[model samples]
Target chain A: MKSWLTTTDHKRIALLYLGTMTLFFTLGGLVATVIRVELATAASDLVTADTYNRLFTLHGVIMVFFFLIPSIPTFLGNYLLPLMLGAPDLAFPRLNLASWYVFVAGGLLTLTAMVAGGLDTGWTFYTPYSTTFSDSHVILAVLGVFLAGLSSVFTGINFIVTTHRLRAPGLAWLRLPLFVWSLYATSLILVLATPVLAMTLLLVAIERGLHVGIFDPEAGGSPLLFQHFFWFYSHPAVYIMILPGMGVISELVPCFSRNRPFGYGFVAASSLAIAVFGFLVWGHHMFVAGQSYFASVVFSFLSFAVAVPSGVKVFSWLGTMHRGSIWLTTPMIYALGFIALFTIGGGTGLALAMLAVDVHLHDTYFVVAHFHTIMVGGMLMAYLGGLHFWWPKISGRLYSERWGRIAAYTLFIGFLLTFLPQFVLGTQGLPRRTASYPPEFQFLQGLSSAGATILAVGYVLPGVYLLASLVRGRPAGDNPWGATGLEWCTSSPPPPHNFVRPPVVTDDPYDYPRAPQPTITGVGDA
Target chain B: MPEAVREPFADPAHQRDAVALGMWAFLGQEVLFFGVLFVFYTSLRVRHPELFAAFAPRLDWRLATVMTVALLISSFTMALAVRFAFTRARRSLVLALSTTMILGAAFLALKGWEYAHHFEHGETPQIDLAGLGRGPGLATFFGVYFVLTGFHALHVLGGLGALGWLAVAAWRTPASDLRGSPVMAVGLYWHFVDIVWLFLFPALYLAGRLAP
Candidate 1:
């Protein structure tokens, strides 16, 4: 325990992040389950309206800041980035460890705020209501989030420097695995955008704490400016959440299909493109928030522009799989799920990007469903898939492949059952963030609530098996997947120094075989 | 003899590159950190152009100029410290660093005096009822002013801590152990804080200077 606390090893830090993030995920997911149960009837029966507001706010904050934002990058990226690049650890190992502590401290502080009677201004925390009204623990929550943002900035700086300076001797930029490429791009967003969010939150905390008027319009501050500043960091924040997940699929698709990712350069470029285009489109979120029509038009157009790079990535993934040998591995299953859900989510985002459609759908369950599909369906699946894919490398034990498939399928189906109805209810004009809704929406809400059961089971199954595997499962060999990345060449649960010596890259990433021999491990191995 | 290399880096040069790159990445975010305030300030200017103009002369630009000069000189000394560290001149490095820190402290000292000046004249973010009734714009102008300078001061304090740490390291460690990269990293941060002040002075003090 003491070693875990003091170790600056990136691998251990990755596990540290994994443990805390998983705890937060369960916390957030539990709140979500309660939310769905409350929605099973249109009566606000499970939680009070005020309590419901706080609950949803807590749910969004925990999941976004604690779980999803740090999910793949902190753990998966932390564990793999060094190994992938053939470096012993991240460029700044101590900084990486420091970020985890900061993240957990931030999480704890936010939890304290919840215990201190919870914030009700929603996760976005728009002005006037957040600053002037809504008597909750806004200052504590905002400061907690600010600390988390600082942690991300540190992680971003570490990743950017590591990627730029720590690659194995011959691993040129173009030769990088798409996962590394995506991470590099994700770090760019994290470095540039997360600070803006911190500053925005500081402005929020200042107004609330000092009774100042940076965002309070009654005191000559424009409330709309708060929206502008908030979304400036936030829209890119969603990318920070998803791009790393996309990085996961980019690896999974090629490895499972036994082919290099089709249009590797485009796949790599698309990540950077997403980062660049992400900043230009924050205005789209402000379309209905009293921003000027001219600004909205430009924002709406650029918002649609973001979809192009997204489509490039999707088509490239499908193309990589089109004629290649395919495996029905658990990670592959989750990757396919990610592609489907993210596409649907991105498609809806395009529809919402349209000024007229957005005017109708803004603040409705449609927006909620859209982000959930992208985040939960897309990012969450990729995270789980990557975890399973790297499970052996991390723990030196093979998770039960049978259970893995079962959990993946269950989670995918459960996610669909939960959110698909919301799309319909959303278009039917059911507003979001309310405890009670029209009785006509009860059936869909019930269906949604029922799906939470499967999601819980699916979520929990791996937790049990993955932990049990650590103690009792089959010992995984060095290259269980026959994957060709530098990480695969290293031992399972690699040494303190990742490699005996940093391996030099001699070929492109994702160099694969058409009719490859089955990997050393197989189904039911555990 | 060169400084010992850290793990994950093969050589001192490689580690130096990483430190440099890391510092730049950090400063990149630091820019956005202050960039938000500038963006908000610009948004305010757009919304209340005349209000900013009317309040511009209210600030003591002469005091701001003195603070600016101190910061600019400190940045110069910081650059010299970086050069001295690279040359293994510990004494010169410490002297240059001490000079930078003193200049930084002087700037903050003057800034505190300026804050007291504003407080005495009732030009503070703490808008009482009368200030609010007179004009919220007045309170908000002070609000933006204090936040802008306050955050900058916090960063200056942070830089001072870094510089002090490096100064002690330079003073105690052998010339070989006192690596250039840490000194360079802190130098980068100090210059960044200086550059931010360069922008902040113009935006806060000068943008409204020529107004009636």
Candidate 2:
């Protein structure tokens, strides 16, 4: 326990983040359940309207800030970045450890805010409402986000330096794994975009605390300016959440397909493209929020432009799996689910990007469905896939393949059931962030709530078996799944310093079919 | 003696380069940090020019000049400290770092006095928001000024803590085995704070002067 607390080992830090994020995700998920339960009926059956507002706010705050943003980057990236690069550890292990502690500090503070008369400002923390008006714990919540943003910047800088400077002698840029490329792209956004959020949140805190609000309209402050700054970091933050998941999907696709990615370079380049283009489209969120027509047009166009790279990735993954030895393993199922769900998610996003369409869908259940399709459907699915894919390597144990399959299918179905109707409900005109709805929407609302329960079950199933695997499951030997990254060359759960001997990358990443080692499926080995 | 080399690097030189590169990246992050405030200031100034013109001269520029010079000298001393780190001049490194720390502290002291002066003129911490709607919008200008400089002050305070640690570390370490990366990184940050003030100096102290 002491070693766990004091250790600078990247692997240990990864576990620390994993444990913390899981707790937050579960908390966030629980909040989500109550939200869905309340939404099931037209009347506020489960909670008061005020309580309902607070519940969704807590869900969004916990999920977005605490879990999704840090989900892959801190948890999976921390553990695997060094191992993939053939380095002993991240560029700054101590800073990496510091990032986790800072994140937890932020999480705990936000929880305190939640407990102390939680804000109904939504996670966006839109100003005037957030800074000058709403009397909820905006100061604490904004400070919590500020600290998390700082941790993100540090984590991003660590990855950027480590990937650039610490790659083994032969691990040239082109030889880099897709996951590394995805993380590198993700870090660019992390380092650059996060501070903008920090500044916005800082201003929010100052205003909220001192009654000297920057976004106060009575003070000549444009609330639109606040939205501009908030989304500048946040929209890129959306990509930050998903790009790493794309990276994981990149790894899982080729590994399961038994084929090299058909458009590896394009897919790699798309991550960078998405990061760059993401910064330009923050205005789309403001089109109907009193923004000018000309600016909204430009923002809407840019939003569509950003989707091109995302589409490039989707097609590239499909092409990679076109004729290869396709395995319906648990991870692959989630990857497949990701592609299907994210396609709908991304497609709906484009719909929302249209100037006219967004006027109809803005702040409706459709918007909720659209992003959940991307975030929950795309990012969360990819996270689960990566977790299952790397579980053996992370824990040095093999989970039940049968059970893993069960959870993936259940999750995919539950996700679709929960979100699909919301898109229709949105078009039919049900606004989001409320408990009471018109009686007409109740049928779909009930269906959505039922789906959330199944989704909860889907999420929890893995926890039970994954924990069990740590003690009783078969030991995962080096290179389970017969993968080709440098990480697979090291021991399962890795050593204290990661590798017993530093690995030099002599083969290409995902160099399957050519990875001469016999495949050990980790399946049926027990 | 502090170790000359750290882990995950082949040698001290590689370690030095990585640390330098990391600091540059962080500086890029900081630029965006200050960049947002500059943006806010520019838009607000453009919207309410006379209010800014009226408010800009309210700050005692002479005091700001003193603060600016103090920060500039600290940055210069910080550079020397970094240079001395590479040269393994422990005594010189300590001298330069201490000088930098003192200058940074002095700048903060002058800033405090300036804030006090502004307070005497009713530029208290809370913005007099009534000015935004019906009056000179002087509060808005002052609000931007306070936030911009306030964040910079926080950065300098954080820098002082770092610089003080570097001074102690330099005093304890054998010159021959001194690692320059940490010193160089801190130096870069100190210089960055100075550069921000260079921008802040003009933006706050000069930019809003009305034509004639």
Candidate 3:
């Protein structure tokens, strides 16, 4: 256990992140369950307004900062990046372990805030409210988030350096897997955007601590400035959450469909496109918060424009599926679900981007429903699919395929039942962050709550079966899924150095039949 | 030199190149980190030119100039240390690194003095200057001032630690690995911290100063 704790192996660090993030995911899920139960009724009987606020805030904070952002990139990316790139390990191995410890430290600090008192500011931590109005543990929470941002910075630096400096000799840029491309793009955003968030949070800390007027209105500071800085980081941060999931699907879709992505160049380019354009559309979030009309119009246009790249990706996936040996495996099921749900999420996002529509939907449950589809429906499905797809490669064991499919389908159904009604409630003018709603909205709210229970089951089933598989499941060979990547060119649960010998790539990535097995130059033979 | 080539890389040169590239990538992120603050400071200045002008006089540009020179000299000494590492000149490398640390400490000392003076005059983020009204704008100017410089000072402190570590390693290690990637990596970071100050010095101290 101490060896596992101190190991600098990228694979071990990946497992550490996996175990830690899963704990945070479960905690976030439990908080959401409480929120659903409280909203099940028409009144605030389940918890007080204050507790509800804390519950939801904690839910958002944990899910976004601790779970989704670190979900794919930190775990899967850390494990698979070196394998995919044919490198022994990340550029800075010890620093990689340090990042994990830093992440845990940040998590502990935030948890301490929850224990001491709860932060009531929403996860966005909008200014004036976070800076002046709230009387909770805002400072500790902000500090926690700042530290988490530091961890992200380290991860980003590791990835960018590893990718740029460590690719195998023959793995040219075009031949790189779409997952690597997506990760590289995601790292760019992580490196550039997270610091702005760190600084903005620091400003919030200073404002709160010093009673300075940096964000408070009475001090002539523009609250809009806070939004600008926060969204500058956070708007791109949404990509940080989903772009890696896109990377996961990029791998899963081709492998399950038995074909390469339809437009490989377009698919790879779209990730970069999304990252670049993601930064430009942050003002759309501030349109209803009193930004200039012209700025809103510009942001609205950019928001719509950014959808084109995502649409390209969605079409590329469908095109990959056309006329192929499509296998409806568990991972494939989740990939299909991601495509459908992310489309709905992206479409609703367009509506929200429209200046007029956003005026109506801003601060409404519609926004909540839209993002949940993207985050939970879109990103989480892809996360589960990637986990299932790579399970053999990671653990060298096979989970029950039958159970995996059941969980995937159940999660899709439960997710739809959960969030679909929120769209209706939102369209009917139910504002978000409210503890109580009118009696009429209770039916849909109750339905959403019931769906949450099912969703919880769907989530728990995989944890049980996956853990069971570790001990009792069949031993998987190196390439269980018959996928094409450098990662499959080695033994299962690969050796400490990953490759027994350095892998020399001789063919393009994802070449199902024609690609040659990578030549392993034996140790000291390079 | 053999130890300098860590696993994964086949040769010492490759390891050096990779480490240098990694440091450059990290520096890119550092640019954006300070870039956001510059954006915020610029927007605020554009919004209230008169208030920033009023607050600009409160900063002692002479002390800031001294600190700027100290930082510039530190960057030069850091470059010299990296150059000496290439030549495997252990004594020169150690001398250059220690010089960089001393200059860095000097800059920090001057910054500490400036912060102390501000506190003595009640020119804090919480309080307005003596003659300047307790307007949010004035408070915001000082708020931005303290936060920007405070964060930069933290970076300098971090750089000093790195320089000190490199100095000790240079003094103790065999000549081969001493002239390798570690010296260059730390040099890149020190240079980056110096660059951030170059921006901060002009943006904070010189901007909006009335001529003569």
Candidate 4:
């Protein structure tokens, strides 16, 4: 803990995030278990209505802000960015460490708020209710969220500059890897979208503390305006959550498929397109919530526009796999799962964009299912896949392939079982966040609860094997996968400077056939 | 390709250029940060123009005007400091940089006084508005003012604290390489903050169609 406190190293900072985020993920999953358990009985027998509210709120807050948002970016991006960019460290090493401290401070404050009676405003902290109605520690929780947003901004700034200024001598812009491009796009959104969230929360805090009238309808302020500002940041924020994961999938698929990514330029630009279009589609989330009619039209068209680039990516991945010698390794399996699940998530999003349909689906379990598909099935799957793919590079050891394959399959199946019935329940008009529901929806709820148990098992498998492997696994030599990147040119666990001698790139990244077989197993000039 | 003939000055110049371009990119994010608040203020003003005007007079224009000038003068000193320090005039440059920091502190002190004055007069948006007006639009105006000005004030105070630390470092560290660069970079941020207030002054304090 003391070493973690004093370390200026980026890898150590990633470890700090890894330890802290893993704890938050477990706590968040615990709350989710309570939620499923409560709903399993069909009556509010396990907890009261208010307790149920707090449970779901804590689940969303912990999962969205703590788990999903930072899952890929903080842990993986922090470890890999400098290495990929061929820099000694991130451009601002002290600022990088400062971000981790800020993350910990925010996490501590949130835990304090939870223990001191818990915040019931959900992660959104919507006005009027958040300002006047909630009984729990709203201000403290919102303050934690504000700190986290600032931390995200600092990280965004670091990644953007590092990518721009620190590329190796011959690693020109066009030669850069897709994962780096994805982080660059995600960083752009993080820098732009996060600050609006900060100010929106600040307004909420001020309104709660000092009778400010920002979102008070009684005070002639529009509640819809609050929705606008909140979603403006948050809608793009979903891209922030998923873009890095998509990046991981992009890297993993081509490497295991034994082919270069088809249309690298297309995949790279899609990331930026998603980032820009994401900002325009926030009002689609507000379609049923009384946003202006013109705003709704604009959002719908922009949402449709956003789908094109995403579709291009899906096609490009499929194109990459068409004639390639596909290896069904665990990471590749998860990548396949991501393409399928993210498609479903993306398609459902398109369905919700149609205002008439969304009017029926809003606040229903369908919306819940759509996001979980993207966030859990897509983002979490990609993150786990990248974790497996890069574990060799990161830890200099091998996790068990047998357990990894089993866990990946289990997670895929479990995710489907958990979310598929929610679509049915939502279509049949069952609302989300209810402690008790009518008996007509009982069967679907039961299936979901059973599925939740299965998903929990899947989630826990990696934790068990990954930890065990750390102690007992075989050492992974550099470039275990035979992938072509500057990172693989170094030791499996890189040294303090990341490289012994600076690599000068002369070929396209991921050029497999021209590369030597059995994967350049040692550092080039180390 | 003789390594010795690779232009002795070009490498450092390139590094500085990279740093400058990266800093501008960062400043672009800062614009969006303050821009979000400005967007909110603009939309709210459109919703209730009269009420915005009614609350505009209550904001002490005198304080706003003074802070504006202090910030402008600080910008001048910051420019001179960067200009001098870059030319390797270490001593005069440090004094000019410290002058900018002092001016920034004074700006914040005046803002604190203005906030106190508003509090005492019961002119805060929700607290004491009976005599001011009864419309909900008026309440919305005060809310926008508080959010924008209050956020701006926080940035001012933060900038002053950072500038203070930079000043201490300037005095202690030898006025060597990266010295002028750090100050110049910080000056860019400070000037940007002032530019935000330049827009804010007319928007908040002089918003209404008053007799000039």
| Model 2, position A324: C-alpha lDDT score | 80
- Looking at candidate 3 chain A, the ten consecutive residues that score lowest on lDDT are A517-526
Candidate 2 or 3, higher DockQ?
2
lDDT at position A212, candidate 3: 67
**Cα lDDT of model 1 by residue, A432-477, tens digit:** 9999998999899899889888888999999999999988988888
Q: Rate the local accuracy (lDDT) of all candidates.
A: 0.90, 0.88, 0.88, 0.83
Q: Evaluate model 4 with DockQ and give the value.
A: 0.36
Q: What does chain B score (TM) in every candidate?
A: 0.93, 0.93, 0.92, 0.84
lDDT of 4 by residue, A1-526 (tens): 7877987788889878988899999999999999999988789999999988889999999899888988899999999988887777777677788988898888888888999999888788888899877899998998898888888988898888788877888888888889999999999998888888887887888888887777776676667788888998899999999999999988987877778899999999999999989988999988878777998988898899999999988998898888887877778889999999999999998988987899999999999999999999999999999999888888898788788889999999989999999989989889998999998888989999999999999999999998888899888888778777888889989998788887678878878655444442332210
**Candidate 2 segments whose C-alpha is farther than 4 A from its true place:** A516-526, B128-136
TM-score of every candidate:
0.98, 0.98, 0.96, 0.95
lDDT of 3 at B155: 94
What are the candidates' individual DockQ scores? 0.70, 0.61, 0.52, 0.36
Give the Å error, residue A495, model 2: 1.3
Give the alpha carbon lDDT tens digit for every residue of A282-337 in model 2.
99998888888999999999998988899898888899898887877888999999
